[model samples]
Target: MPRYSSRQELVQEMRKRARLFIGEFEEIAEQDKDTLLADVDRSPAQMIAYQLGWMKLIQQWERDEQAGLTVVTPHPDYKWNQLGPLYQSFYETYQDWTLVALMAEFEQQVAHMIDLTLSFSEEEFQQSGSRKWAGSTPANWPVWKWIHINTVAPFKSFRTKIRKWKKIKNGLERIL
Candidate 1:
């Protein structure tokens, strides 16, 4: 039997999960410059970039679909390496947003993508061609899972971080 459901519905679930990330993102943003600068194992930007990557792929898929440009034959720019540049460009352009707001944009973009793809009829969706999809980066076969993973996983991470940071921030605030 052929598989069904173009995307994993993970992004949709992630939309809810992303909300849990907001509080953590706020604490991280509110971190004293000293704390963030001293412990530089990773930047918040790095974490945001990962989510940005998934959101971007969703955005691109939506764009192509709207343009009626299906069958995304693999091209050099469409490669994984190219994804970094697109992400960096987004960061550079949207540098003003706080982490929470950026997360909101991420949620919005993914939701738009899911709305676009989820509406596809079986005939339109199952047209498996030379198309490159977000899930295509992992294993093309489990595109739906990739979609869900990309959409939901980051938000879950965001939520966990938020919860931890909020607790810490609250404690720190109590000390003052």
Candidate 2:
């Protein structure tokens, strides 16, 4: 993903990648959502859940900061180095949700994230350390970078994963 110069560019990419990513889930059978493939690490359900986790976390961080609380970079419970467990926690968090529900919630969260992005001014998007929660990283990344990483970047990568999973699943079906 390219560096977003403005919030509009960021939001545009968010919607574009998110649409493509979520669209792939339409072909995934609900029963197969949790079916892990030999190649792809994440099931269809896990992929959506991971997205929801990050979207919600970003929203929460902004909410906390707005409420005048010191914001934690990722989450209060997990440290930067413990991201593996953190991701597992995300999987567990939405494990019971049906794939449809997960996708619906992800869509809603994407819209909310877009709204949140629009809420920020161009100056905030461009300037590093604009948001305390966002700047806690060593690089002091701008708000747009955080948004791009959490949204557009992962959406594209996860889309590829799901596509690969789909092909693998189809191949297995044919062989069996």
Candidate 3:
């Protein structure tokens, strides 16, 4: 939810949140990545896949636009209301990978996203309609907003989810 005025600030926050999110998963056992609990909506592996999915989608939109192709918001196969199915596809896409591999991919994707973000100009970060794909949304967010929404925002939110998951797994909570 933090608003960044500069690309440097955006990247800094992105990297910081990513570290915090990934750090939460470090202590989780690889064998337990797919273990679903009674409370948490997603498993550890699902969390990584969800992040990876959105990051890849953002990169794809940028790549498609840069290549002079019509870029899709979300995807051609899915609409805004179809997000649940889209997320399921994301989980299925990376389900076979080990937790360690998913984490590595997530880290790598974050780096790639940061690099892509740096390629934009300060003006582009502030101005709406900078990218057709980004502008297509009802919110009409700029490129930086898209990046922050997919990266920093979710990283912070999901970090909390992972913390709760860890607490439950470790039985570190009280019934009160």
Candidate 4:
């Protein structure tokens, strides 16, 4: 639903939101990184891994589309409605990773996303139906929408989740 007039605006917004999102993790203690709040099913580490997984998936979609291959929206083995299992896969893939390592990998992925975005021309960036994997049923989406959903929207949403977890955890700690 959001629109960007230029690639620079899109990139800037993505970077800003991502920085704020990742900054939330820096406030959490290393030991508390895995603490699952009462209302939240995922720990900070799991959330980071999920973000990494989606970023990688988006990048892969771009690569595959550019190569003239049929692009799958979520993945070959997973459907849009099957995200729970896909998320579980993300957790399993990074299960042995420490919070610090996960964060570093996330940062690297963000950088890679930025680079990929920069490679697109303005028309390619804003053109509707630019990528077939973006879907065509209800309405065609511009490439910017795809990038925004994968980056900006999730960054903002997950930042709030992490903040909520910290608040609840800290509140519980004080109560105890």
On TM-score, the leading prediction is 2
lDDT of 3: 0.92
Which regions of candidate 4 fall more than 4 Å away from where they truly are? 136-138
Model 1 lDDT, full chain set: 0.53
Candidate 3 C-alpha lDDT tens digits along 51-83: 999999999999999999998779999999999
Q: Over the stretch 1-176, how does candidate 4's per-residue lDDT look in tens digits?
A: 57889888888998899899998988777787777878877899888988899899989998998899988768889887898999999988998888789889989999998998889899888888767876533567777888888888989989889988988998898999
TM-score of each: 0.57, 0.98, 0.95, 0.92
Question: In candidate 2, which residue ranges exceed 4 Å CA deviation?
Answer: none
In candidate 2, residue 120 scores what lDDT?
95
Local lDDT at 15 for model 4: 86
Q: What TM-score, to 2 decimals, does candidate 1 have?
A: 0.57
Question: lDDT of model 3 at residue 1?
Answer: 64
Look at candidate 3 and tell me the lDDT of residue 126. Answer: 79
Worst 10 residues of 4 by lDDT: 130-139
TM-score of 4: 0.92
In candidate 1, what are the lDDT values of residues 1-176, reduced to their tens digit? 22434434443455566656544565565333113322232245545655776666655664675688763523324555675565566556556566666657766776675675566554445554334553344555334444455656666765555455446655777999
Q: Name the candidate, 3 or 4, with the larger lDDT value.
A: 3
Report clashes for each candidate as comma-separated counts. Answer: 5, 0, 0, 0
Give the Cα lDDT of each candidate: 0.53, 0.92, 0.92, 0.86
Deviation (Å) of 91 in candidate 2: 0.8
Mark the regions of model 3 whose C-alpha exceeds 4 Å error after superposition.
Answer: 172-176
* Winner by TM-score between candidate 4 and candidate 1: 4
